[model samples]
Target: MSDTQPPRVDAEASTTADSANAPRPPRLGGLPLVGSTLSIARDPFGFLETARETGDVVAYDAYGTESALVFDPEVVESVLVSRADAFRKGEFETDFGELIAPSGVAFTEGERWRRQRQLLQSSFTPARIRSYAEVMVDEAATLVDGWDDGETISLREELSRYSLRVLARSLFDLPLEDDRTATVIRAANAVNRYASPRRLAIGGLLPSWFPDRVEREYEDAMADLETLVADLVAQRRAADATGDDLLSLLARAEYPDGSRLAPEAVRDQLITFLFAGHETTATTLTVACWLLGGDDAVRAELERELAAVCGDRDPTVGKLGDLAYTEAVVREALRLYPPATGVYREPTSDVVLGGYRVPAGTTLQLSVYGIQRDERWWNEPATFRPERWLASGTGTEDGGWTLEDDSDRPEYAYFPFGGGPRHCLGMRFAMTELQLALATIVRRVEFDPVADALEPSLGVTIDPGPAAVRVRPRREK
Candidate 1:
C-alpha cells in the first residue's frame, strides 16, 4: 500500500508472460517449507547453484517481503561502494538493532557513524596495531604452552578463547585474569545464538517484535556486558589513564569540538570491538590451521619462512610483515571462507545495475561468499590455493585477478573486509593478530587433519564444524 512498493502484477498475466518468453528461476526442489532452508543448512555452497539457475540476480520473497540477491561483482560494488549512500545496512543488520541498541560504529549511520569513526581512527592505525603485536605473540605463546603434544583437539574453540583473551588484553589493557572475561565470553555466545538464522529471519519479518524468551536472554546478556564495560570505564576514569589500549584511547578520545564520549557510547564501542574484533580473527585462524593441516608442502613452506625471519624470537611489531607466507595464507583463508558471508545494503534511489532496473528502497544482498569463489575470478575456485596471491602475474595489470576485468569487478570483486570510506577500521589490527597467531602455531607444532573433509557451518560467521585435528610438537632439525 506504500508509495515506494514495487508495482504489483496480476498472477495470471505474470504467469502467462513467464510461460511465453522468460526462463523460470531455480525453484525449491524439496518439500515446501523445508526446501531452501534445508539446502542452505546442508551445504553453504548450494546457494551458488541456485544463483546459477536463477541468473546473476534473483529475488526471494521471505517473511512477507521481497529482497533481491546479487552475485555479480560489479553489481555488488555498485551496491556497496559506488552508490553506497543510497543504501544503509539492510535487514541482516537492522534485525539486531534492539540487541545492539547503542551499537557504536557497526549499527550507526550518517553523522553518528562518521563522528565515531573519526574518534576511533587513531586507535587502529598501523602504528597502534603494530604496537600490539607483542601482546598477540605473548598470548599465543600461552596458548601453545597449554596444548598437550599429540592431542586431537577442537582448534576452533581453542582459537576462539585465545583470540578473546588477546582482544581483551591488547585492546582494553585489561588483564586476561580479570573475572569479567568469563562474563564477556558468555554474553558473546548468547549474542551469537540469538543471531542465528531462525532468529534473524523472525527478526527481519517483525522488527518491533521480540519473543519473550529471546527478550529475556538478550536483556540478561546485555546486563552482564553493561556491567563489565561500565566497570572498565570507571577504572579508566578513576586512573585518568592515557595508554595505548583501545579502552584507554577511547576514554581519552574527544570530538573536534572538544566533547568526550558519553558512557553509553563508550559501552557500545566496547561491545562492537569485543564481538567484531575477536570472532572473525578466531574463525580465520581456525580455518587457516585446518587448511594448513591438509597441505604438507604449504605447511613446511610456512615453517621455513617463519624460521628464517623470526629465528626463535617471538614475532614483534617490526617483524610482522616479514611473515609474507603467513600473511598470504591468512588472505587465502579469508577469500575461501569470509567471516561475514554476505553484505546487505538498501538503495536510496532508483538505479540501473547490470542492465536491470533496481528501484529505490529495495534491499540488496551482496553475497561475498559467492563473489570470492566465482570461477570467473579464480582458477580452481573451490580448491585452497595460497600461491595465486604470491604470483605476480596471477591478477590483471590493474592489480586484480582476471575475474575483475569488467568495470564491475573492482568495486565488487574482492571485499573481504569491505571497501570505501566505511571499510573495516580494525583491519590492520586484525591482520596483525592473525599473522602472530599463525606464525606462533606453525613454529611450535605441526597439525594433521583427522578427517578427509571439514564441513563449513554458516553461522554469524562461517565456521568449520567440529574440527578435530591431531597435533604434535615440531621436532627441531
Candidate 2:
C-alpha cells in the first residue's frame, strides 16, 4: 500500500516513554517577549535552517508559547502517527482554523473531529473521486482553450482559476463566474495573511477587539466567505433532487443518532473544502509547471508518456493509471513545495521526543518541507527529478512507466498531504485533480518560464511568487 494511504491510527502502542531524567531539548534563543516571531516573519526558511543547526529537537518560545521545531523523521512520526492521541492541534492551528473554518474538521478535536471525519469520508471514497475526473479534465481543457499561443501568464493566477472552477463544479455542482473567482482569490489571500508570523507577532501586542486595518480586512474577507458559503448551502437545499456533489452529500449526512448537520456546521464544511480543495491543488500545479519549464529532459519524458497513453486526446479517468510520469511530476513538485509548509501539534501530556521531556501544551513544529528534502532520506534532495518516483523496471505492457515502491523510505519523510488518520480528506481528490489537469494541459500546450528564478515566500501556503510562464502549442504529437 502507498505510505500515503491511511494507516490504522488505533495502534495500541505509543512512541512516548516516561523518562523523567530526560533533558529538555536545546533551545533556539530569541527576543524576550515575542521570541523568534520576527526572525520567522523575516525569513521562515532561514529560521528553519537555524533550527536544524541547533539539533533534531530545538525548543524556542514562539509568541510566548513553549515550542520546538522538530527535524528528526522518527520524532515526526511519533507526533503525527504513533503517538497522535497524545497531542492535539496546537494553538496556531486552532486560532487559524477558527478564523478560516470554525467548527470544521480541520480544527475540531477528539470526538467532534472523529464524528465529522466519518460523516465526510463517504464523499471522498475512491469511487467518488473517480466521479470527479471528468470535471477535472473539462476544466483543464477550458483553461487551455482560453490561453492564446505564446501568451505570457502567471501560472498561479491561471491555475488557481482552473482549480477553483473544478472544485465548484465537482464538489458544489456550481459554475463559477469571473467575479466569484476573483472574490475567492482575494478572500483566500486575506485569510492566509492572518497566519503570517508578522501578523501573529503584532496580534499578540494588540487586544482582540482592536480595530486595526489588517484586522478589519480579515473580518471583511471572512464575512464575504460566510456569505459565499451561505449562498451555496441555500442553492443546494432548494434543488429539486439532491445531487452527488459534496455539498449535497453533506446536506443529507446523518450522525449515529440521525441528527443532520446544522446550517452553520454545513457552512463551515463548505468554506473549509473551498479553501483546502482549490488552493493546495493550485499551488501544486503551479510549482509542477514551473519545475517542468526549467527542465528539458523531464519535460520530454513527460511528453513521451503523454503521447503513449493519451495520444492526441485529452486525459480521462481511464488513462490516469497509465500516466505514471505525470503523477511523479506532481509528486516531485509537492515534495519540493508542500502547501502546509509544516504540521503543528501540542503535547496533550508531558511526553518524551528525541530523548527529551516535552511539557504538556508545548507546541511541536514538524517541518514537512525540511523532512522531504533531507539528504538522509532523499538522494540529490533538491533536484526536480520525477524519474526518482519510478521503480527499477523496463517499460510496461502498454509502454508506460511503473511508479516507485516507496516502502523503502521512512513514512514521515514524504508527507505533503500529511499522515495518519488526519491525513488530508481531499488527498485522493487532489491527486486525481492534479494528474488529470496536468496531463490535459500538457497535451495542449508547452510552457516556458518567463522569469528565471522562483522567489518562494512563507505564507499559509508557499506562495510561488512571480511564477510567470509563456505558453505555446506543443510542436510534437
Q: Give a tens-digit lDDT track for model 2, residues 265-313.
A: 7778878888988889999999998888899888888888887888778
Predicted structure 1: lDDT: 0.71
lDDT of 1 at 292: 92
lDDT of 2: 0.82
- Model 1 TM-score? 0.83
Local accuracy of candidate 1 as per-residue lDDT tens digits, 221-290: 8798888787778889788966766788767655657887776677888888888887788889999999
Clashing pairs in 2: none
- Clashes within 3 Å, all models in order: 2, 0
**Model 2: residues with Cα > 4 Å off, grouped in runs:** 1-17, 205-211, 252-257, 393-399
Question: What overall lDDT goes with each candidate model?
Answer: 0.71, 0.82
Best by lDDT: 2
Model 2 residue 219 lDDT score: 85
